[model samples]
Target chain A: MTLTKQKNQLPVFKKMSTQPWSLLAPLLIVLLGLFLYPIIEVIRYSFTNLRFGRIEYAYTLHSFKSVFTDRNFLDMVRITFTFVIFSVTFQLINGFIVAFAIYIGEKLKLKGSVFVRTSVIISMAIPGIIIGVIWRMMLDESPTGILNYYLSLFGFGPVRFLTDPKIALISVIIANIWRGTANNMILLYAGLKTIPESILEAADVDGAGSFRKVFSIIIPSISPVLMICGLLSIIGTFNTFDMIMSLTGGGPAGATEVLALSSYKEIFVNYSLGKGSAIAAIILLINIIMAMIYFNMNKKVEV
Target chain B: MKNKKTRGKKVLIYAIYILTAIFFLFPLFWTLCLSMKTVPELFQVPPKILPKTIHFNNYIHIIKNTLVLKYLKNTFVLVGATAFGTLLISIPAAYAFSRNKFRIKNNMMFGLLIFQMISPLVIAIPLYSYLAKLGLLNNYLILIMIYIALRVPFTTWYITGYMNTIPKELDQAAKVDGCSRIRIIMSIIMPVCVPGIISSIIINAMSAWSQFIIPFILVDKGEKLPLSVGIINLQSTSEAITTHYLAAACMISVIPMVLLYIIFQKFIVSTISGSVKG
Candidate 1:
């Protein structure tokens, strides 16, 4: 049916022979000038030794070699991967659990569900940088800090939250989880709301408990939303910079240096434009690969 | 017996809900309480959950002492310019992508998706240099342009999704009634896409307001800084950990957004859900 329509539409396309290039030209130019030009410039500069005081345009792989061989580079890569994995995994699980719990609570006509949902939304509204600062203050190792003060009430010692290398990554992770879980909750809550009540009722009639109903009905119903949310979480976690930069400054000996932070440090702080661009390009490539994998999986599932 | 068990379950659920609510709201509550406390009181041996003396001067001091007004003005201007610019370009482009059976339609859509996926940090280096060459560094216009470009793809994608749901027959009927293509778009399509426009406007405005990384890197001059960057600067340069001052700044930054959220909470939530679902 579509093929025949396409055959008929060919004549109409021919009759309307005035190409819309005039309309499209300006948009194309804007994109090329603003978006493409910078990208091309970055690629061009990445192969050369570009610095603050000097622009050595001579093509060399020296920067790439330095990035590959530098011990800090390897450590940065390891730390970045660890941070992304740990943060994203925890966020996904925590977000899913909270969202599901909220959904169940709402279904039971639980009091204060509205307030719980509102608070979640408010959390989403807080800026990431501010959240970092606030968490830093709360988790400050000083006796006067809120977390430490509260801990002392229970006879617990101050746990070095941001200062300790071992716990710094976890501290940042917790901060990110707090800032980001609201986004996931909104997504999952929306997904859950779209599920027909009849399906759950039918499952309940089959002698299914709430746990069984959630596992069998709700999970499968929202699988697509979950996949998209997961992919978003992965991408966002990989690119997170502000929280880490503000909180730990990727400090305590680069314990919490994610790729984005490391890339920024190389580019601006260290002025290694080539290596920084290389890292940036590598991050982009990884993101693209992940997105492609996600789309492919989504297609298979759809089929 | 069954009713009693269900009631018990309901009570348990309420308990859980209340606990989660407290957990979620604790930070904001802490900020509010700390805002009311003096620095010395805030840093007391046992950190004061409530202030002994409420410092109403904190809010006044933040406004009087810092460039809070300038930052707010800068942020508003940047956000307004970016939101308008993005909408102007994206709405027409999205219409073309959705309604017009143009060649390369799929390619354009795919290109937008790719752009959306790529992290901004990846392109920040060259963007900085490019803007510098153009003499646009530390300029609000440069930030505006970057915001527009960064947001256009997502805005276009979302508007395109919304546009697809609008029946094409409406366009056809308008054309038959002697309407030009532009007129058809202006009259028929624009009116129909109000929900999408509203959603995009709110979402983009919020994003532009909260933008940190781009503005932080691009704008070096203190006067050009947005509220987010300005707050960070104030924090770093200030001598004392003045909880009141910090909280005051935070309140200044967030109050407008909070009010906006309250006013348009329903539309905002619906639009967010719609965009995500699409």
Candidate 2:
């Protein structure tokens, strides 16, 4: 009788297993066909001497060697690292500060808090490309440019915001910070909201000052959110392409060229398909490594 | 004495708040002012903080010259098509993962997560080459396909988290009521999951509409370009840097998205917060 019952349960288990596969099969097929296949093809192409005409017929490490040895490759690597580090740091600091201000405003029932928060939210809604264009137009060095025009009134001369190589990277960084910081603020704000009011009140009752409360309670409470936000900002800043493309075009002597822009120019503009793919693969590797290191270090934090 | 101190602090807080608000909003305010000036007047020795005359004609000129309607139409179609397509595929997959434990489930989910983290730019070159080979370059269908592929992992993860929150008892009861799997999904599961679905749709739609890099690299033809690309092209090709026209274009390009955000601001903001917290 026991054997019979166990035998009957086998069919049910089999049916349950089959059901998921039935639903998942089509999705798996599409992912394999559309996403995986092309990625594999790119990996294959990266090992070859594939170029404009012989893309289908060549296979070698010639392109990889060329990419590694290219004079500008190291510069590109340095620029990418610098961009990611600076952008993520600034974005995190600014994001947390603004989020703290908003949270305090909410607690105190400050006037115009709602308006300020909403406007910040609206900034996230604007597309990056549009923000880039708007900044580019505003920072035009001509006396009539909005930024220059304002400066002149204060008895200052027009500044070469985009044209000056020294400032071009900074200009792109500002546009990026403007477009991106809101998302982080929203995330951090949400994290703040999740912290119970009682805990804060308890701290206040204990005579904990604002700075003490923030350091002792708030930071520890929101550390997980900060980790996630930091990881996301790192990934985002590393992968950023659109703003850089629009604002600087990696111009003024390639002053603003990041990995994404470099790979793009190589693949599309120069038609060095193999080298481009190699650069792309390297970027992919860097992201994966950093993400792995992050997860390993903070294994207890849940996504 | 305590009340007076509180009042003094409140005043100080208000002063700081107003100053910060002005500083944060300067760019938008500056853009608004510049939108009202003609090209020549835009370049005056002192920048026009406020325009003397409102150049409503700038909007008309920009609209006429840039084919703004076509760009808008393209954006709508691309966003709608991709959003719908992503949801249709992702929902079932999410359900399967969340509700059904089966062979290779863990591996598949892991794969999806890894793919979600991969940057689209890394795949752009290969995808472009493959699409070019297939003669599918510049086609809207390809864009839709690529967007769906790129977005599926995140959408699936999002929907699965939501699906997991719903009780399994409901599904069991629906199954007992002679509901087929398909019917149960459509009738029982989807209705209860509207909030998640809406969040997914809005988030994906925003990304799709705002997407620039993929479309920039993929599509070559001007007529096929979306608003993001189209606006850039317009600004670049214009004979002179017409601040008014650029601002007008910027304003027009921003309106639809801003309107959407306004309409769904509460849901969008809450959903974003929820997603981050989760």
Candidate 3:
């Protein structure tokens, strides 16, 4: 019926298309110039041997080869996996713990839950760089450092947080977890609300223990939210280098240099655009894999 | 017996809630303490939670000694323009997407989803060279344009979702009354969409204000940097500013955003949670 009407009013339909296209013109042009063109350029540059100093370049596989063969390449790959996995795991756990606490608190008619709710999100308001600085200060091993100072009160001396290669990645992960927990909390808190109170009450009537309800019912019900938080956390941690730059600068001998930071240092600091673009291409591939997982997860959930 | 058990659970829950609140709030509290102490106090063997004497001078010191004032000015213009430009560029496209049956609409929407997944870091290398090649490096306009490009996909997707709720009959009525498409948007659709648009602006502004990498990579001059980059730049200066001064600077960059979050707590909380809800 709609097709017949459109055929009868072909002039109106034609005019409609014209207006929509015109309205879409600005977005289209901007996307081409900034988003699409640059993306194509990144992939293009990944296949070239362009450096900052030299103008002439060849479309060879030198960049990919160099990036893959660099002594630190496998190290970076390991660091990236470690960073993404640990950050996602701990962030989700912290988020769920805080969110569940809030849920239980609200159920119990506790007034302190409001404070917990407000406090959990405060760090999210902070920029990643600031969070890095604050946490660096917190984890500062100096005599004046707050955490260590308290540790001394308990007979523990300062621990090397950022200096030790063994400990530096752990510190970065902690800062990232702090930077990321609020997002997890928000997403999972929203998820928790979707489980009807009636369901919990029924469980209570059935003599279901708290652990059982949380493990069996609550987990299954919010599986989609957990999946979202997982995918988003993975992709987000994979791309971000700001906090890491501030906290570690991929430092104490490249101990904390994730792929994003490595690509950044390659292009800007090292002045090799091709290698950076190659690293970026790899990052993009990882992102696309995650995106594929994201799509498949959404499809599964919908089914 | 049931009542006794329930009360014990209640006590445990409150204990967790209070402890969690402190755990989350500790870093900011420590920063505040650090920002207020004198330079010597920062290095004192036992760090004092409350300073010997609170100094507001660190805030004064940064403005007097650093490029913080200039950075603040640059950020206001850069972030303000990016938010305005994003809304301006995305809203029309969102309206068009929602109202019309176009050949490329589905494809365009899907493309936007893919683009949104590609972080700005992934494209920054090429963007740097591309902008540099055009002799547009360090130009504020290019940065703003880049931010708008980065922000448009999500904003368009958000506003399109918003526009779908406005009944099309209103557009039909306005058409019968001979109102043009643009005029109807400005008068009819926009007014109704103001709440959604405000949420979009707040979200966009938050992200833009926090942006470090893009601006850090593009704008080379200290005088032109945003707070996220500016404060870090100051932290790395050779003169070796004290921890207290650095803390003050971090606090300076953070306070406004926290204040904005506090003010828009309800709107932000609901919008973020609701945006991702099934």
Best by DockQ: 3
Per-residue C-alpha lDDT of model 1 across residues B1-278, encoded as one tens digit per residue: 77897787677677766766766677777777777777678668877777777667788888888888999999899889988999888877776666566677666766666677777776677888777777888876667778888888788878887887777667766655777766877889989999889888888888888778788778889988988889888888768537678877877787787777666666667766662442
Better of 1 and 2 by DockQ: 2
Clashing pairs in 2: none
TM-score between model 1 and native: 0.93
lDDT of 1: 0.75
Q: What C-alpha lDDT do the candidate models reach, one value each?
A: 0.75, 0.77, 0.83
TM-score of each: 0.93, 0.92, 0.94
Q: Model 1 chain A: which ten-residue window has the lowest total lDDT?
A: A1-10
Minimum summed lDDT over a 10-residue window in model 3 chain A is located at A1-10
Span of 10 residues, lowest total lDDT, candidate 3 chain B: B269-278
Candidate 1 runs further than 4 Å off:
A1-26, A294-303, B53-55, B275-278
Taking the tens digit of each residue's C-alpha lDDT, what string does model 1 give over A1-303? 000011225443344323555545545665676776767776677677777556555777777787789888888888887877777777777677777777877776666777777777776666677777677767868767787878788988788988889888888888887877777777788888878888888987898976787788888988887886777787878878877777888998889887788888988999878888877777877877876765565444334
Task: Summarize candidate 3's per-residue lDDT along B70-176 as a digit string, tens digits.
Answer: 88788788779998999999989988888887676767876776677887887678878877878777899889999999899888877887787777667767776
What residue pairs clash in candidate 3, if any at all? none
TM-score of chain B of 3: 0.95
What are the per-model DockQ values?
Answer: 0.46, 0.48, 0.56
Candidate 2 positional error at A101, Å: 1.6
Candidate No. with top lDDT: 3
